[model samples]
Target: MKAVWLAVGLLVASAASAQDYAESDGAMLRFLDKLTSVTGDVTLSRGQAAQFGRLVVRLDSCRYPVGNPASDASAHLTILDDATQTDLFNGWMLASSPALSALDHPRYDVWVLSCILPEAATEAVEGE
Candidate 1:
């Protein structure tokens, strides 16, 4: 068991170390109401908060691969249930693998779609 865990840790360390990331100004997020089967999209800047259903979601930070913005996206989030006044989730969510770190809510499902790059990066991508 120890050996397996060590191997997994080494793999994760290597994968994380090899990537150079750029800080994004914001992210595009999607919210879904499981009961109603309704969904909506919203763009949120860092430190911005939005209300979806009864949940208040705040984006703390967003990041992506430096030169490959489409490759992957990750965002730090703080979510709270306004009605219950309880913290539902607070962690990093990955666009590539949202299930790995997801917001656990009974009626609402939220996930990151992509990162909103900086002006320079956005221009570069658009120009290409």
Candidate 2:
């Protein structure tokens, strides 16, 4: 009985959380060349990849709160180091507080800036 109740509670929580956010096709990210302190924006669609110096950054998806989509963004990213053939970072990064879940690298730093929705999605939101 206890297990059954726990499962029910988990489902309820997930459903509630889902209603608070919406998924997007792409995300805008900022990258810093630590050595030179050069910074720029990189926009990536879901499943698209971009190279920055020795790093390959890929965006899997992005999400933002429904009420204030531009205020905060979170994205699933997969970063690879080409020279080492290793994945340096593979997780979600938030725009509002990047240091909370930052990419640790000696020569490069990346963080989410905003989630980019498709034209249809943007229109739908505006229509509402």
TM-score of each: 0.83, 0.82
- Mind giving the per-residue lDDT tens digits that candidate 1 earns over 43-62? 99999999988989999999
TM-score (C-alpha, index-matched) for candidate 1: 0.83
**Model 2 per-residue lDDT tens digits across residues 1-128:** 99999999999999998899989988999999999999989899999999998999999989988776667899999999989979999999999999999999989999999999767657866876
Candidate 2 is scored at a TM of 0.82
Model 1 pairs whose backbones collide: none
Once fitted onto the true fold, the runs of candidate 1 whose alpha carbons sit more than 4 angstroms away are: 1-19, 126-128
Cα miss at 83, model 2 (Å)? 1.1
Q: Which parts of model 2 have CA positions greater than 4 angstroms off?
A: 1-11, 119-128
Pairs that clash in candidate 2: none
lDDT measured at residue 50 in model 2 versus the true structure, 0 to 100: 93
